[model samples]
Target: MDRRESGKTPRQLVPVVLTGAMGKYGGELWDAAERDGRIKPGRGPNFTKRVLPDLAPLLRKDALDQGIPRSAVDRSDRPTRGVLIPPEEGGPFPERLGPCGWSSEDPGEFQWDIVTRGRAHWLLARDAVATGWLAAAMHGLPHWADSEPVVFFSTHTRRSARSRFGAKFRTPPADLVTVRPDPLFPELRSVDAATAAVQCLSSVMRGKKTW
Candidate 1:
C-alpha cells in the first residue's frame, strides 16, 4: 500500500482556482494594461507610472540599481498566477438586472423575491468556494496556471416558500456553477465577495499581496 515508494509521486499543484466574480474581473484599466504589455504575457506586474513606484522596491536588491529597463523585466518569471472577473461582468448576473426593476411602485409586485434570494445564495457560496481556493494557494506550493473556463448549471424556475422573510433570503444551490437570479447590486453587500477574493490571493502570498 506504499504507493509513494512504488515509483509514483504526488502532484505538486492543481490547475484550477476560483475567485470572486465581482472583484477580480478585468476592466478598462486591465484591458489597457494587457494591450500595452504592462502585464507582459500575463505574468509581469502591472506598470502604471503611478503604481510603478509601489512595485519598484519589491525588486530584489541585486536586481535593484542594476540599470535594468522596466521593459526588460522577465514577465514569465512570476511565481504566482491569477485570473479576473472584471467589474462589468462580475456580480449577481450584472447583465441581467437593471435599475428600472427595483424603482417601481411595488418592489415585490413581480415575484422577484425568488430571483433575489437565488442570487444571494449563489453569490454567498461563490465567496466560500473562493476562500477555500485561496487557502490552498497560501501553502506556497501552487504554481498558477492560465485558463478561463466557465461552467453553468441547469436553469430552474421555482418559487420560494419563505419569500416574505422580511429581508432577503432564499435556498442555497447544491452546485457552484448555478447562476444568481437577483439583479440588485449594493456596494456594501458586495463587500463579502471582495473580501473572499482578497483572501484567496492574500493567503497565497502570506498577506504580502493586497488586492
Candidate 2:
C-alpha cells in the first residue's frame, strides 16, 4: 500500500509552455532546454543577458529620471530567478521605481501599474500561469484591479517563485486548469476559479494576507 516503498511515483504534470510569439517579440532572450534548463546549452548565470536585457536598465532609470537623488535610487542587482511578476522591491518591472524597499507605509518616488505588464512578463517567462483573482480577471471576471498582487500558479520547478509585491506563485493540485481566453495569448493557462478559491482560503488559514 505504500507507493513510495513500492517503487511507484506519482505521475508528472506537464503544462504547455509557448514562446514562439514571445520569441518573435522578445528576440531570443533565453532558451528552454531539457537537461540544461536555460536555452543555448547554458547552465551558468550569465547564460543570456541578451534576453530582456533592457528591462532592468529601464526600471533603474525610472526613478533617477524623475529627479530622485542618485542616493535614493536602488541600484540593487536584478533577481537571478525567473520572476513571473516583478517584485515591488528590487524588481525590474518598469514603471515601479523604488528606494529598493518601497511599501504602503513608505512608498518613495513613484510606482505606476500598467495593465499590459503581465503580458510582457509572460513574454519574458513563457511558463507563467495567472492564478487567483488575477486568473479570474483574466478569465473575464470583472472588478479586479491592477493594484492587487498578480498571482500565478506554477508546478514547474524553475518557473515557480514567491515574492514581496510583484508576481506571487502558488502550487496546488491544479486538477482542472483552463486557458484565460485572450485574443492575443489564448495559450495562457490558469488554475480554475474553484482551485483559486481554495488557494486563497488556504492562504488565509495560513495567516497570509487573504488578498
Candidate 3:
C-alpha cells in the first residue's frame, strides 16, 4: 500500500490549494513543503480554457466572403465568458449564439485545458475540480481508488465556485469529507486528519526525490 494509505506510513505529501486570481495558498504550501524535508508537495494547477468558433470574419464581412471554411478561422480569439446561447427545453444546443457561443452553456461539451506542472492558479484549481483532481492534489483528499480517509476545507462564510462545481457535477464520494470554511491560517490547524495529510505529503516527497 502507498505510504499515505497505510497507517504505518507517515504523512508525507503536503499539496497546496489555490483559486485563480483570488488566492494563492497552494503555491505557498508547495514552497514550504519543499523547503522542509518532512513535508512533500504533490499536484499542480489544472485549468480549463474555453474553445469556440471564431467569428472575426463574420464581424468584418456582412456576407460570406469567398466561401471561407468555418473550420479555417482561428478559434483562440473567441471571448472567454458570456453566454453564446440559451439552453433549449429539449434541444442539444440553443437556437441563438451568444458571445462565447454554444460552448459556454454545456459543461460536458466545454473544452478543458489542463496542465500537469505549473503554478497553482485559480484557473488550475477550477480545472482540477472540473477534472476531479482538486482535492487529491491540493488538500490531501482521497483518490477514487484509495480507501484512505479524506478531509475537506471550504469557505464556510460563503459558497465558492469549487463547492458549486462539485455539487453540480456530483463530486466523487472519496473526494468529499468534512469541509469547513477557508482557515484564516490553514497552516496553523491541528487535527488528526491534518496530521495524516502531512504524513501522506511526506510520503509523496520521498517518492518524488528518488525520481
The candidate that achieves the highest lDDT relative to the unseen native structure: 2
Sort by TM-score, top down from the best: 2, 3, 1
Clash totals for all candidate models: 5, 3, 20
TM-score between candidate 1 and the true structure? 0.15
Residue 19's lDDT in candidate 1: 35
| Model 1 lDDT per residue over 96-186, tens place | 1121111111112222222232232334233322122221221111122011011112224333234332222223345433222112221
**How much is 52 displaced in model 3, in angstroms?**
26
- Candidate 1 vs candidate 3: which has greater TM-score? 3
Model 1 regions lying over 4 Å from their true place:
1-19, 41-54, 58-211
Across residues 30-80, which tens digit of lDDT does each residue of candidate 2 receive? 222112221112243421211211222224454456564565344332222
Q: How much is 71 displaced in model 2, in angstroms? A: 26
lDDT for predicted candidate 2 compared with the true structure: 0.38
CA lDDT, candidate 2, residue 191: 67
Best by TM-score: 2
Taking all chains together, each candidate's TM-score versus the true structure is 0.15, 0.39, 0.18
